[model samples]
Target chain A: MIGSEEVERETNPHSIVSVENLVKSYGGREETVRAIDGVSLTVEAGSIVGLLGPNGAGKTTLIKSILGLITPTSGSISVGGVDVVENPNRAHAKMAAVLEGARSTYWRLTIRENLEFFGRLNGEVGTEERKRHRQFLERLNLTEKMDDVVNDLSRGEKQRVSLATAMARDIDVLFLDEPTLGLDVEGSFELQQTLTELAAQRGVTILVSSHDLGMIESVCDRGIVLDDGEIVADDAIENLLDVLQTRVYELIVEGGVAASTRNEIERAYDVVSWVEHRGCTKLTVAVSNANRIHGLTGALVRNGLQIRSIRMDDTDFEAVFASLVYDRPHVDESRAARGER
Target chain B: MIRGRRGRLSSSVSILRALVTRNILIMKRYPLNTAGAIIGLYALFLLVYLGGRSLLGPGFSGTLGALIVGFFLFIMGNASYKTLAGLFATEAKWGTLERLYLLPVKFSHVAVLLSISSLLVTFFIGFTMLALMLLTTGTSISLDLVSILPIVTFTLLSTIGLGLLFGGATIRYKNISSIFGLVKFVFVAFIVAGPTFEEVFALKFLPLVQGSYLLQRVMNEELRLWDLEPLELSVLVLVGLGYFTFGYVLFRYFTERARTAGVMGHY
Candidate 1:
């Protein structure tokens, strides 16, 4: 998908958000920390990008630079074709962000007032903007609480209001950090659904950064993973999985396996995680070779351990992320310890 | 959506209107806070008037009229100073400061709109408190709009510069709010400063003091702004413009520094 996009000069012509070699460093020469080191990527129009990274992986630094919250030490960012560094005010009109999920709106302001304030600031006026406001209120499910001050809202409701407040603006791009942070199951699902609608229906490009891999899997068209201030992987979610061959499968056994079988299982397959749950052992086994699942299952049954459930976990982004950053060497490490490398 | 450079005038008005609307809505929401502010304003004035009266006894009547004018200017100066300087810190506290930076216009443009809105509100509150003080004391100064308006405008203009400077300092060195709170008390010094432009020519541009002197004359002598010496009026206008320009440059510098430092949301 990234290759299919048309390139004009260094950046894709259709990309609503583009950054080239962005480098942001903090502190001085003796002990400089490059928070963002030579990062470059482009988000095409209307695509939801999930920026996945561990803590201190430069995700925040990258988002802040693109949003014009902070200036990059080197390189360039452009929003909707306006160079961010050269003309920030012009680029600002094209972007908005819910940086801290629920704290974006004024706590003392009523939900409607917050919307009106942000909306008007985005250049939407009186009667002309009512329809847009009404639509988002309805979609975000804040219609009933429109008259209520934000301070009275529950955490979930407040997060929705924050999203609504940011989205109410006339913007071509929206950057959300931890978008599903305060949401429960239904709230997170609804937010994903709304984000899907925003991208698909309105063609509003979104760049979402969250540790919620499941939510990211459900909503994003592409996933970009960062590690140690550099991008470890960037591609379509399915492609990332396919290329990494992250054939991770979760095996829930009826009971705990004997020490010998467990040791043998660890030696045979790459065990990503082993946990005991409800008197059963849950082993996340990574099958590097896609055809090796049957061998592992046969060995498990032959060892007198009754199989409870077997399903491929490759569709889970956590598996793909682990393969990318935790490194595929996890299996190689296990094998090489026995001189298999 | 942003209508490009062509939308400059319209968007500016829209932004100003939005700020005014947001402010009024907040004020309307907290009626008690608004009322409390007025009462607090009056209480401070009364405290000063009583303290001075106690010290001077009956002779305080001679300075009563001057004290009233000084108190009015102090309210304006104090409010003006706090409004601009405290704005960034409060917004940062509320988490809306970054949003202001994200506006289509320069961040300073948003500050100006905010300043205009606050100016109107502070003026209303200041005048109301002024009225309350006059009613309690049964004394009135010349309320000539032609004379007082320009002088008051210049006085506010000068503090805006301080606001910008302190505001910029806030982004770089956050949680300096207590410093701004203490700085407002310096208005007392401005109030007591020598009021003669002829005595000290350099004193003409001394922030609130010079404006206070001109305003004291306007209220006491019923003198129009034009009635003042040409040099005095020009210098007053220049001082307002000069301080504002100084403040804006410093604000821009600190804002840029804050961006480089990436500490806008530190507080």
Candidate 2:
């Protein structure tokens, strides 16, 4: 049963997918696995949301529950304002999913047959719909291979066909699980471009789950990071990156500093690693803010240490992801340093 | 706005047509396998009859016509009985069951569509077997088309219901092929031995007994549509509808259980 709050949220016209307090456990008493634990999220319409998680982080379980493929232990998932648990068929009518593996299509059929069959199943079998399906094929660069058997196509081609079949349907929400698992660099880029275009042009709400952080960082507007079946962070990609970034500097100093000055420097910054080489000190310092680099240099100069060279560490999506999931205390240095007591 | 009854009905029909067409296209790809199965079953039956002719003597001629009709009905009944379960197993193996369930339509609708398509192919095979039997055995059939149609339809309904019941079991158990094989063996034994026995009241409750009896009478005893008593027709109709409804409900129940267990794609 959905709570009044969830019921109210379901009516949000901008929200295409809403999941509240979803809990799913599998297996018997002694051997059960709690796949999802009190996870809640909302995917707005016409936006691409990236579901990022490590293995066994309940990404697939969450996606399946939202798609109405698996029943949750206790929770409510509303897709396009329809409760998927109570009226799965009705809810499924407004959505389509391409699972991680190519298990969504018939391998024995040709590409065109697979698209046409799924289109018919989704009630998109009109002449105009068929033309649209062909246009999709052409846009995906699969027109020449339309007649080829799906089993005969390469894995990348098969993945494209799966995407085409899902896109061929006029659904409000599209769920893609690991859409670029085995694609080459070029294929992955092409798929990312297509998804971006599809969401923008067709106003389709997409929830994509993938380990390709670069792709997720490039294509997604929002990121929902899950760790151990709990949401660790949910925000816009840029904001998440901003909040999760840890500014670290690697420095080489020509003159050795006194023990008191080193202690003061350590008190001001997180000295990740320090070593001495050839009468010089090398220090890796993590600061709360990038501007604190000037303070660190000033403190060092006050101790009469000659600063040779310093470089800020390059931060990417991978770094942000690692910092969030690993619970690295890069974000809250004051609290972390005090907690060490 | 909610979809009206007519709209839902048309959508179901459209999905059914698509499923049937898909199955037909797949069947077309394996034409030789299809033809081989039909011819192979018929040839086995022909060889058995020829090899065992010595045991019957002259009495065989009197019952040859009945035997031929009974064999045809048996083959058709067995094929229909196994179609649903076999299709379910194949779909699970192919990883297509979950995909079908993901559609807006109910899973039972897909089962029914597959059953109907299987029946069409079975009928085609039955006719081929009948043709071969006529050519080799030099036997003439007295087919009461009007009477046979209703009886065969009812009997197929009941058999299909059993098939669906087994198909549902397959979904839950995943490795019930051996059980299906055993159940099918029992059904075959009943089909062969069913009409040979007298019309005991208990025999009517068996899967194909009552309908096969009526069908045999139509072929050998020249029973017409009106010749059947009202009670007999009522019994056939009740059994047909009863089994179909029971099987559909049972299949739906098992499918729901499988869904909750999250094993729809586990086979």
Candidate 3:
């Protein structure tokens, strides 16, 4: 039987942002684009929700509609408790967003000025709040460039300033669209750390769209996967892994190995994929039962291969997202209509 | 009762001031670009002043002086609107306008802030030119500063309102810069041609042009105070209100359209 607490958690109405049947279309004569279809989802208070989708999947459309930056052809959106269509300004009072490419800043403005502008726009924060915003900027490693023009900063630094500006308002909800699109490894990690602290310490509800599957897995409590402008999967990060029941395996063959033997091993078990690198045949096998790998190894040896190493691969979001979404049939353009639906 | 309701309406001026202050602060950080633009405006003024002297004969002094003043005003309005257009254009290009659309504030705040911020820069340039003119042209251009003060303020407001309207269009239409250029051509022509004193009788309803004509008439050594009409003053005020409302409504409409397209940031 399902636990009472589990049911309550699933049915709870404490979400910060909620949308139902959201739709958006553009253009008139000759060409029309249905950007968002019947998309419905909820982002809980203080939880980081990851929105993952391929290009042209209407992720931006969905985000814009929720923010009331765009009107929906048909749907309902509420930020906190205010309806977006009925009262967009009131609904927006609860949310702050950092859009793609750090476009939220005036290039001529200094980083400090950018923050000041956003803080004033938010209206809840006064002049004294600006002094506190400096501390936040320093924490985000933007103190050194406080007086530098926004256009002069590097792309990563510009994004940092954007985040600093968004954070200055201390809003209850934050929406980040591709926050770490082109950041280097260090920059991406630093941003992830800051997001984690913001959500954890401040109880801020965050909805993030990112290509960084690893960061999403580590930081987000739940994820919403969009395919063809529809919600394909909306579940906890752990549940997504459970749905894609596949584990990575690293195998090392010490003896001489033939390509045909590799083929024979593949014939014995579900050889999802494998790579031969530096004398090690690393295989990613999708075994229904864990014990099935032993039988596969026996078959490999009988086919004239010596197994020197066998290691169960790490279980993480990147592998799960790849195996579940990226490796699917949609990557083939022709098959898009079939599986993407 | 309606006037009371209108009086209760909140002033967005504070919002505009905050945004303008921010832009000024930003310009301070980029001193080189600001200095270069200011110097460029001065250089352009000199070129026009010297070049026009030879082309036109006796009336060159008064006409050129008036044209330069009009030119500065025209550029001031254009520059302010250009800032708004640039901000919207850049945001649309970079996908930031999408975020701003999602914010809680009124979308009008976006245009208002841009118009105010850019006007500050334009005013600085105009003031500098006025100072230079005072030093060079010792022939007292009447210097009827007292009478022209209110007219100047109203003129600036009407021009800035036009800027906001165009800025909004830039957000909705990606190639609005071409349209802005075309509109500016016609506007500058109206300002420079002095609109034939007879045209003022017809266009008394137009704010910026009417205000400019009234100021010019009042400041002219030959014109008399008895010639001024009460209807002209009231018409100028009405025209100012009209432009402000027209610009405001148009801005709100486009902002909504942009958001609905899910391309508020679409370049």
Candidate 4:
């Protein structure tokens, strides 16, 4: 986790978007449901941040609140240094979004009309001004389908059109929710490239939420994982791996693990996956401490289970994400999970 | 300070033009729907004109001028009542409602712009239906823009206000088209209320009913808006502004509730 000093710096002049102590609650006073509970974070300019979470994790709610699509019960959200609640129109002028539902464009309007209409809505009416938006279509490989109505396009094409529509205007910050949901490999890659270029070349900050963990790891500069309406993990991509500190190992044993032995293993190790055959058992377990490796093997041998092979498996961001969100005991969640130190 | 906020008039005009163009293009794409609506409206008017004339017999002193003016105002009311509410409900289903809030203007601005767009098109259709009625019934009426425009404006404003109330509710409630049957009954009452009923103060206050009565005065008596009593004009203007302002406020309130409740994108 970053120090408090880093958070202070991050929330300074360089921060284009800042959300503070946001809380959105539902239901009567007798029963309360908070969609986002005191979730705070700052997105610096020209950075790509991935919002990762399981279903019903308040990712969409957070994004919506930041975009001023939904009002938080109590909090402050600012975009480009403008308070969203006090002056949403000004905040919207500096922002754009491809929300969760990929139906932002008029289904009957052609791609050309969608681009033109959105451009004009954002005050980019001139031919020269609109021509500047062509790069979005080109990057999404949708320029050739300019005359096609959104209803006629394939699912991937429709999503790209939505992306192009969101990115068609001059915007400093862009919010996308599950943008890669319906995209194929090529479309996903092109979208990633577009995001990278927007951040690297234009200094446009992006906050995207998607279930595709691999894509988030590959493209995003930082990752934020939310669970149960709170931000449980927020850090750089590499730092997330470093902070997880858990090792995934594969243990192949001769003769299957009896129910009693399996129960013991479950009690000790964080088993990621388990498989058993006629005379073999393959167990993929996550061990937090290095000393637990020998301990596990010694216990297995003591239980009359012969260890055929033991090796460390590959580790990815998913493990780190799972550790933080699943409330694993090894990490000090209060100190490590909250990236604001 | 909105970064690209223009002088009031210029930005309003730009957004209105864009919205009008969008509505026009979408309407053009569905020629069948437009043709079907025109035919259905024409047929309904034909039913009223022919059936009323036959039912009352010759010397049925129901002047075509009043009928035409009343029809025009009714059409205006119908447009005002349905356009905003229907557009919003459809936008919710299309999942485009929340996206409009992303635009660099207030959602109310877009709502007003959309109402204006639909009003302009409704005017076109109103005239077309009038032409058809004139041709079919072999009737004549004065078409004075000077006398008719003010009444039409007030009537449209009142109906749009009523529509905004529903439009706002639809964002949160999702499906409320069941109330349309009641609106149809109200239209019938507006047409059938007699001169005796006009004596009642409350009857005179019915939305678009008041405008219809004022309009008939112009078409049948050859009067202009200027010749109308100050009390008459004042009451109409007051009702129009009052209903519209109330509806607009309700719509804004419902919109905020929708945002808070998180149902804007749900159909």
What TM-score does each prediction get for chain A alone?
Answer: 0.80, 0.87, 0.82, 0.81
lDDT tens readout by residue for model 3, A1-341:
11111222243478888787787777887897777877877678999999887777777778777877778988889888789888887777688788764566777778877777777655535667977797888789889889888899988898888888888776898888899888888888989999998899889998998777888888899887776676666788888767655566667776456788767877777777666777666666767667778787887778777788888866776666555456545455635655653
> Clashing residue pairs in candidate 1, if any?
none
Ten residues in sequence with the least summed lDDT for candidate 4 chain A: A2-11
Between candidates 3 and 4, which one is better according to DockQ?
4
Q: Which parts of model 4 are misplaced by more than 4 Å?
A: A2-10, A251-286, A289-310, A328-341, B1-6, B60-63, B194-197
Clashing pairs in 4: none
lDDT of 2 by residue, A135-243 (tens): 9998889999999989998888888998898877788888899999889998899899989988999998899999999999999999988876777778788877787
Best model number under lDDT: 1
Give the alpha carbon lDDT tens digit for every residue of B1-267 in model 2.
Answer: 117787677777777777777877777876887888887887778776776677787877787776787788877888888877777877877656767777877778777777777888778788788888878888777766778778888887888998899898888778887776776676666666666643676666677777777777777788797887888777778877788888889998888777677666567
- Per-residue lDDT tens digits for candidate 1, residues B1-267, read 456667987788888888889888888989998899889988888898888889999898888778888888888888878887888888888778888888888887777777788888878888888898889888877898878888888888888888989999999999788888777777677666837544887876778777888888888877877789887788888988898888888888998899899886658
lDDT of each: 0.83, 0.81, 0.71, 0.80
lDDT of 1 by residue, A1-341 (tens): 32212223354778888898889999988999888877888889999999998778889889989988898999999999989989899898888888888787888889988888888787755675778888888998889999999999988888889888887766789999998886899888888999999999988999999999998888999998887677777888887667655477898888888889989988988989889889998989988787898898899999998889987853666767766765645435745686963
On TM-score, who's better, 1 or 2? 1
lDDT of 4 at B230: 92
Q: What's the count of clashing pairs in each model shown?
A: 0, 0, 3, 0
CA lDDT of B39 in candidate 3? Answer: 75
Alpha-carbon DockQ of candidate 2: 0.47
The lowest-lDDT stretch of 10 consecutive residues in candidate 3 chain B is B1-10
TM-score of chain B of each: 0.94, 0.93, 0.79, 0.92
What is the fnat of model 4 with respect to the true interface contacts?
Answer: 0.60
Candidate 1 docking: what grade? medium
